[model samples]
Target: MTLEQLQTLNSIVLHGSLKSAAEALHKTQPALSMAIKKLEAEYGFEILDRTGYRLGLTAPGKAFYQKAQELLLNAEQLHSLGQHLASGNEALVRLAYDAVCPHNLIFNVLKKCQYEYPQTELHVFGESRFGALELLQKAEIDLAISPWWPTFHGVGDFQALKIGTFEILLVAAPQLFNGQAVTNIDQLKSEVNLVSEESELRFDSENLMLIKGACKWKTRDMQTLKQMLLSGLGWGYIPRHLAEQELKEGRLVPLTPQGLDFSIQGELCLVRREESTLGPVASMIWQSFVPPL
Candidate 1:
């Protein structure tokens, strides 16, 4: 089928009716209905259950719609690749980082790219968990530096390099635990545990790494979570570097209890789609992830 027909079908599914899909596509209802009829005629099966007041996809229609989505995705990727080739240079490099990506390392990478790749434009944004991964999947960003690993198989031909290791420390305001070491997971359940929202990047039960079944105050940013802990709202696992000052000043105390390791290790990884080749400038930034001599 034609791309227009596929896109029309997608709009019908999204907007939930022929009239709404027609309005969205700026096409008349008759034209939209005719397109679906053509597809049904060629396939020898009804694509939609039109007997209802609203249009709904039949079993075959649902399956065909999934294939249409894949076709649309590949078409968009093909267009982007063509643009990249026509530009001679990649022109723009989009980088996404999670909360745990070391600030010092990021600055170092950017500083070097500034001097070496002055012609290239750099765009940076912060994302946590698999949020950054979602951007990469959509080809919205060139690379992702994330602390969480891919939880599923067949995540495209994405290459990931271990860039650094950061520390995750479970700490709380001194009075949150009433001067008692947190030995059991259940002890913190009653208290609000400030934590990042559950993310798709977590392959393991890292949520259970902390106090399982605890009432959690979910936050979008790790810095915010640290602030919540500092305010005595809850306790959570904060990166060592981010909480260094509080730990040193005695505002936040690291939990140390027998049989419970409150500290966990986290890896900072550089991720990118393997199919896309980086320009010289983007390649320079990639190399900056390496340690200095």
Candidate 2:
């Protein structure tokens, strides 16, 4: 019935568990459970179905959560607008980015916004794209800056926005390539190590495009993979942003071996709660700063 109760219900649905929703809210499990219980009483419906360790939303729960998302967004927009108008200051904006995205474009854009909208406050968080979705569903983030996972289509909470596209590069420390740019799959296997990014997460497909090369390591963490490549440990396919500095500095070498081409396709994406209203300050950034995507 209340915003907080609706939020609790939505968070459970988003995160699929009380423990995670509690963690996102920085509340204890017991507190979250009680909040949900309170909502169940007020609504006279069962919102969650326990599945061993997972929580599934009932039909009504799913529909209710969608409305809650809109309501929360609207409430935040109203609050942000009033606060900004009263003080004539920039309003607080919280956002999230995909951790796999090393471009740091969001930082640059925010910096530009700082100069343009001096009264606006921007707070940012870094999370994997999947984690970012959780933040989006909880209405914890004002905007999401990351790559689009098409599977995300039809998620009712977001108004998805396309930004721009970037490239992924096959790279490694110079030593791995022995100072020669790789051109063929056989050469890549013979000359260096291959680090495959476990991309099964966003794709949801068992079949992956494994670059034909010598396998050195496999990691799900982009940071760990970057560090490993930086240490001159092995070669891997890395996001262009992460390898930009290294490539510029000649610390990392680009290898165009066979099957090396990889990209996220199309453009970067943004998702915000469709129902939320934005203050003038937040609206300016959202409308003006997307940069022709």
Assess the local accuracy of residue 207 in candidate 2 as a C-alpha lDDT between 0 and 100. Answer: 28
Each candidate's lDDT (Cα)? 0.79, 0.70
For model 1, how does the per-residue alpha-carbon lDDT over 1-293 read when each residue is reduced to its tens digit?
Answer: 78888888889988889889999999999999899889888899988887888778899988988898999998887776676557675667899987776689788879888776555678998876556766777788988887645443255578887798877888899889887877777777768877777655435244655566777778878778888998889888877888899999999999765566788776778888888887776777788786677
lDDT score for residue 261 of model 2: 62
TM-score of 1: 0.63
Q: Which ten residues in a row have the lowest lDDT in candidate 2?
A: 198-207
Stretches of candidate 1 off by over 4 Å are 1-87, 148-154, 201-210, 258-261, 291-293
Off by over 4 Å in 2: 1-91, 99-104, 112-121, 128-134, 149-151, 155-157, 180-224, 260-265, 290-293
Instruction: Give lDDT for model 1.
Output: 0.79
Residue pairs clashing, model 2? 73-276, 90-119, 90-120, 164-268
